[model samples]
Target chain A: MVQASSQVWSQQIIDDIHAKADLGRYRIRGFSTFQKVTHFDDLTFLSTGLTRFPLEGYKEKCSTQVTLGARYASEPLVLETPVYITGMSYGALSVSAKTALGKAASMVGSASCTGDGGMLPAEREASDKLIYQVLPSRYGFNPHHLLEAQAAEIVVGQGAKPGTGGMLMGVKVLDHIAESRDLPSGIDQRSPARHPDWLGPDDLAVKIEQIREATDGRIPVSVKLGACRVTDDVKLAAKAGADIVVVDSMLAGTGASGEALLDHSGIPTVPSIVMAREALRDMGLYGTVSLVASGGIRSGADMAKALALGADACAIGIGALVALNCNRDIPEADFESEVGVSAGQCHHCQTGKCPVGIATQDPELEKRLDSSEGADRVANFLNSMTMEAALLTRSLGKGDVRSLEPEDMVALTIEASAMARIPLVGTNKVFGWD
Target chain B: MVSLDAHSLSARELNQAIKKAALTGSQITILNPQARHNIAVGILDSCKIDIDGSVGYYAASLMDGPEVNIDGNAGWALGENLMSGKIVLTKDAGASVAASMRGGDIVVGGNAGARAGISMKGGTLLIGGNAGFLTGFMMQKGRIVVCGDVGDAVGDSMYEGVIYVGGDIGSLGADAKIIEPSETDLIELWGLLEQSGINDRPRFRKIVSQKKLYHFDNLERLEMSAV
Candidate 1:
């Protein structure tokens, strides 16, 4: 008898099709992509032994400090570590989660971004340096808030749903969330894909100027693009006078998104950084205009690999949330009974019934995660990540994380070799590219 | 009144000068404006600024409190994201006039380019002449008074707010419908026109959001079962 299951047609795929057919809409879920793309794990650093001596972990001072957006703004973002909390709005993540992220970043002398939901007052008060985001939705967009921000990030798009805007299910669009966004309660919010004022790149230049003018050029302005056409987008963003350009890859996390978009759209982090770095290099603006990478940055190894590939700094989303007990099963929550999936497999943030308190709007669920405790956990994770990156940098005989360049690493796979433009391991040749 | 020559100073220099001058609530005038971009931008204080010639993109944008009078043709995004204050344009204005303006008043004496008053959150935009395409797109609140004809898809995807068109409507946008203006609404609109010093008030037609596009049509199993 023939095998009932085929290799191409997995049960999960079949289930997805059935669910879509029944629902008459694309699947919606949280977290990032499940696509097995080449990532930071595919690159390995060539640590020093004979060519140079490695720095001692106990004695050597391997600085992880990075300054971003120095090209235009008088006051650039100064951080002790490269990793900062990326934008994940209040509507998407609970207030407790935002507060914890802010508190965590402040504890580590890093920055926390106020994502799509505008600057939550609680987060702003908790965060020492907050990146105020200007999204297409313009929800709760106040010029007064723009004045108070350390830096401003103009969001062109997100990696999870590249072409589309933010999606918050009606369940998550509670009264306060709706009130902040100036929308009616219980309406499923779909943010506009295009900015209201500016249209194209030329217009974006003027818009950047407007932002600079609005803030008196005191803080740097960053243009955050969902990584798709990385080369051209990066060039355009730089030419448009962005102080920093953030390349958010497909692996970036989201609160809620159409499952099709998460799985199908955008490029992975490995190639995106290479393309963006080369794009800036072509314009002779590589180091002049800062490049920030955000996507599936999991550990210190990933951060170190990305820094070596040309990312000045890295922004994290899901990893930080995980430290805040996002998917963890606590004693107060029942994953199987509440969300139908176990703690590790659940992606039900769109449902507003999160098993962990990080992603929900419900009062009882939000109570499960203590902001102060979550802050401690996240700060510990950040410290660990910074040490890991610094450890690898010192291993490469480097005193600073920024000194770890592409020549210090090689790709483990042929796909990675081509995408990262680095030589393959044990081979001088870079595969698939001359 | 202090006057600065636009040709002599750089864009940065001119804006900085304006900011410095606006601090003292001084009335200032710009000479040889030359259609420069970002003129008198970020002026937060309530002061009078007169531009002698044409202006370029983002003219008088991101301002909180300043009454600016542009004497010639204006470029795109005139008075964009204005918090409070007023801007009067004497000639044709480019696209996205008063775009995303939260509060205050903007009066364009001539025709306005496409996307005039797009995504307007609050305040009043009075276009004395015709307006181009997609005017008042995604407008959350406030009033747009277009005295002359409007191009295609006017009031497209407006969530709330009333667009009073005095002349012909090229066509209506998705989820936009024209309705007879109430006497009180017309009286209020005409009163605003009178305040802006526009003499004639044609037969005004009010366009509003049908409110059908507010929410999605369907939901998933988890969404349906969610609390």
Candidate 2:
């Protein structure tokens, strides 16, 4: 008998091949990348010791508020916290989940995005400030909805699956979702990769102008890019006249995606922020163009690290989903029976049998999650994150979150030192850059 | 009637003025447009607008209910995302004319560039002259009537819509199939052309979705059961 080596071809790789042999195509799954990369965890905060004096962590008024996209728009998006919920489409998520997220954002005085699936009127009513996403699919995109938004995000690409469109199985494409998207029901929907009208950055510039015109120049226009070529893409987007540029790294989550893209595409979140910040600073548009970073922000520490890496604001998806009990074992749901996996191990969002009811459109499963209760939990989570970030800012002797700069942090790992462009701990040498 | 010279006002100022005029339901005329982008955008009211010269990208776009007339040429994405309106263009239009229009009638007297009526949700786009490549590409639910020839890959990957081509076909797009039009479909095409004052009786071929790409080929046991 031949011994199978795990390095050359692991058991999981063999199983993946067997599955593809049976399925005849690339496998689809959900959640963020399974491929481990250097992340925010690799960076460590250097609190006030001898060089700086620490403020009272409990009492210091460390402001977490941030203003985004004040360059061109008459009104910019102001959030009480530096963290906001990222765009997760209604079709990809249950309407109940969308409502809860909107309500939670409103509770925290932060912004919630309308995602790819247009504006849910309920979500609009729930969210005091909403960012309307103009995605490639243009699904359920209405000018009236555009008018209702506080900001507009033109999604050039996303971090989860860059250069490709989104895919939602037929099981989730219910009547209401279908009607809103103008799609025939019960068809596996693959969203178009390119915008219907515009093509390149030049065309994107014109499209931004059109959006500005559509909104009567009231709200800011943001350009969201998947962090594939962060430097060049950021420069082009800023040159294309984006008021805000969002660099969503490969750490981003998705409702459904080809497993290949999840592991193989785009740079990690650490480098994505550093590169995007440098891109803006190179063009002298660093402060003028608000930089929002997303992908794999699991906690307030991650958000703090992102801010330290030069991201003006951070967007969260999987963290918020976890707060909403995504992988939690609820009494009514037998995750093993329904999804053939344990609660914490499940990444079966593509199957539409989400035991927690956050990702599923099934009415019976949807009953498991109460929107109001879910909103409360998410609100609490957002508040806790705010406090933790403020605590860190105060510990660093910074009165405001914006004052938490790269100089306040050091890299724990050599990879992080290079990617974050910060000095390594113990030795004052910056890797790769030095 | 109110006449606003495009030479004097920026696109923002012109649109703001147009909105103000749209409130009172008045006729607005724009002169010397010089192909400036984003002219008369986001006017969501019942009114009439007339442009004397060439307009640029997104001319009369994102409108709900309005009748806009353009005497000269137009740039890209003319009448984009128009909900319910009538856009009559006497000359040529650049790429993506009437893109993503929901409900409206856009009539182009001259030729249209590539991607005309791309991703149209619901509307009727009538073209008197030829249209360029990828016409009716990814059309969801709408009707595109072209009286003359179309360039390569017309009606590519249309989900649920009908494209009536009166002249020669270039090539079909992926998941696009050409089917013989019914008598009613032909009559509808003729009526739309006549409504646009084309006055030409031309036999047309209809293009529709093959639906082959609607669903993925295979799924796992859980996905199969969930569906």
Candidate 3:
């Protein structure tokens, strides 16, 4: 039997369908039919095509270019950048992963952040702009590391597991992590959820001030807050004098136990951004402070969309692993058999011995990853994303990401459109728009 | 011994001037500065310096190599990240003191704050008075001496180190061992304090980490299972 192409249509069928459609009937007497176009004059001389969109386009004329990327938050003490690397402790990954991310960040002229564990020599060496994280664990936190990083962040919370401390079990807490964090090798090292001095917002502010004092004014101090009530918490951070704020969405990666991940706390990406923006706007510091969005940023499109939605930059965690060959090259069946799940159901990364070894600290397995190659791949991915963003800007008839307005974006579903406050396609307005 | 009176300048001015000295590679002494936080930050060099007043937070953060002396009370973090140098605090210090010192000496004349010498790798901390809670919480390698009573959880979760408390210790850390004070402990303490020109010696109780603390508790239990 001959196969029929989906694009194929007969003349009789086309005519029958056209006759049944009211729009087709209405188009028969449209204004374009009244216009005469010759090869010399071209189709441009149509009578109905005399539309003036001001100069260039509606957006170029309506919107002025404010700053793009994250705005440095002086109060909450975070830097200006839309994208940042999430915290991947030294014990979680081998030296290769840290070096790769650091080199990639340096190549891209972006910042690389440290995790709760402590400062790694390779990470510090590779990163040009390093933001050292000081968690309740105080692993590698020292006045020296703080000064070396040129910036400091007090990790008040994480998205995966809130109201609980972080546990770097003895298995993962190897000799180096143990030595750096000053913990014995084989026992579980628990980083308390709350700082000894920090009780709440008010106390947290004082502690932040103390850290700032500890480091001197040279290093900017920032707060990494997990999204609980994004608006309220961000507002508090702003009021508390954080130079920048990192909004970790609920969908962000976690290096914690399943019980902590499922039982504790987290908030989705979209609403988190909305509330954070609202909080900044309410305080009249929306444009003044930079907001770095983390969690579930898969592609450059996602990055562009987040930027358009007011994220300074998007931070990636799992995607970074994907770039480092987390699930690549393995036989699909072997991966399925070994992990006891198909590639599609592979969320068992919390277990350090990932079949691909991307999350493990084992030397033999970790050696499978080459830092230079992995860094190049990550760089290539980031470059591609930047190119995609440029193309999106070009499509919208704009030059930079800042020109993207809420009007330029539309969501696929009505609820999403409402939540994002963008117009639905063909509707030309928001859901309740007049 | 260069006598530079820092009392003539404000805390900010004094720090700027002394840090400028570090930049100029000048070995100078700061006399009676009574300086506050952010003193000598970003200064990594080898110089002999002295301060005669109570200093504030991060006295010598990431201090590379310079002999620093605090003649009075230090607010917090006496010699954080002392890369290679000597710091003598003649008075009490605040919390997280010497949180992660790589190589250096920190001598405290009075009580220390909570989590003092938290992650000291290679350094010596001498506290004349009591040490607060979680002293040497995650100590890797180093020597910490508290002349007076220590608070709860001394050397909790320590990796490896020698801690000497002249008075009563609240408790040994999870993996820390309470060893009898060794002569080596007294010698090191005496050497550090005496080098800094203190030279005061008192009896001390020694504590060190039991290497087994680093193993995974659950994994160890599983490993011990008989098939």
Candidate 4:
């Protein structure tokens, strides 16, 4: 008798359970879920027809300039494009990769952020505008670096692993990464999930004041949060005097994260951006503090969609890695030999043996990526994204990308309509708003 | 010499004045500090600052080279992230004193609140009296010498640091172990005690990192350890 293909317990589920039982530990990997979920793809732009006049693509110029941290900062982050590179730590990526990211961001007139391991001097020197992250672990946190930064981001949580501290496996904890973080070489490092100095939101206010005072109120101070309780967290950040609120949704990528967190934690970017916008608007601070949307933001279309939903800017993490040939085709035998997985099927970033060399610290693998070539690739990707966003903005008859409003967008699905608070396709009603 | 009355000036104004005075290598004195927050913050020059009265939060925070002498009590985070400076507090200090200090010396005359010398990278914190809970918590590299009793959970999750307590210890934190001090350690402790004017040489207990908790070799080992 022929067996049925559609079993009650799928082979994937069965394999996952068996794998957990065998290993006795949850799987750790890079990037987020491949599961089909609601995202910005469920939304479509309502480009100009007869009601709105579309600008000529070649003749008319669409501005994508954005200013972040204008609320309290004397010198806010000014970018030529609304798309920026999100934080990725030095320990997770090689020094060459970090330098490439910095150089690429600088070439595009954008900002690159440092992550949990602290600042890398090469990255700092390469990038014109650098945003330093003040993580809970306080690893490599110093007043001098804080002062040197164009902006300081207080990382409350990351979208890939919310409510959990950062983890760097012993394999990647080489000499420099270890020394910069003040940890012994070849030791697994786990950062605290919470800041040692402060406990709650009230304490956060005091900490923000301290950071502002430390920077002499010159550069902006941002509070970055994973997309959990978006409305409440954004409101709290606003009240705590954060110049910018970076909302990273569950779809955001990480160098290393537990499978449990990546699959079953936090909300998606589509709803998170809407909730954050509504929160800021309700608090009467819609235009005061800038909102940066991140997580699974792949293309310029995603950037335009985010801007229409009221994000001042969109940050790309995984997309930037992809641009740097993260999962591109390589020699299948070489990939298998390095990561024990075939090319295009690799997610073993936690293993410190990346085949394409974008996420590994091993000198042999790291040498695969040339910094100048990587920077050129990143720059090309950024330029393409900017052009795509500009195309969308000009088609909407908007002079600036920031002027793209929710009225210019329509949801393709019911859930998208409700979550985005935009009208459904070929309909006048937005489920939640209408 | 520069003299400023903190009562008439805002914290920002006073800090600005202090910064300006520090530029010319002048001796600055602040009168009626009245527990003002962030007094003499971010001082980067080699100068001397004397606070005649008690100071509020973050006094001499992120100080690089200034010698800050507080005649009265200090509030939270005194000399926070201090880099190459000397902060002398004549009276008690609040929680998180000298937190994350890199290179400096902090001498507190009286007792201190919780989390003294927390995450200290490289420095010397000498407390003439007792310290509260979680003292030397997560200390990476530093030396904390307390002359009086210490609260519970001393040196919690500490990586590399030496904490010497002259009085009784309430409890040791995770991965923290008491070790017998060497002759060199005793000499160093005695020298620090002498400098802090701690004449009574109580039996000192030394705490250091266990180092085993830093990594997980395998899944089964991690599970067994967790259990």
Query: For residue A432, what is the lDDT in candidate 2?
Result: 98
The DockQ-derived docking category for candidate 4 is acceptable
Q: Considering every candidate listed, which one attains the maximal lDDT?
A: 2
Could you give candidate 4's per-residue lDDT for residues B1-227 as a string of tens digits?
99999999977788889989999999999999998778888788899999999998888987789998999998888988888989999999999998888888999999999999988887899999999999998888889999899999999988897999988999999999999888888887887778777787767889999997887645422222111
Question: Of 2 and 3, which scores higher on DockQ?
Answer: 2
Encode model 2's per-residue lDDT on A1-434: one tens digit a residue: 66666577888889999999999998899998999899988999999999889989999788999999999999999999998899999988888999999999999999999887789999999999999999888888889889999999999998999998878888888888889998999788888899988999999999999999988888999999999999999999999999999999999999999999999998999999999999999999999999999999988899998998899999999889999999999898898888887989989887778998999888888999999999999999999988888899999999999988999899999999999999999989999998
Candidate 3 residue-wise lDDT, A251-333, digit = tens = 66655443434333566666677678889989998876667677777776677677677776677887777787776755422
Worst 10 residues of 2 chain A by lDDT: A1-10
Each prediction's DockQ? 0.55, 0.81, 0.12, 0.35
Name the runs in model 2 displaced over 4 angstroms.
A1-5, B225-227
TM-score of every model versus the real structure = 0.96, 0.99, 0.75, 0.95
Model 4, span A89-113: residue lDDT tens: 9998999889999999999999999
Could you give me the TM-score of model 1 versus the true structure?
0.96
lDDT minimum window of 10 residues, candidate 3 chain A: A26-35
Judged by lDDT against the true structure, how good is candidate 1?
A: 0.90
Model 2: CAPRI class: high
**What would the DockQ be for model 2?**
0.81
Q: DockQ order of candidates, best first? A: 2, 1, 4, 3
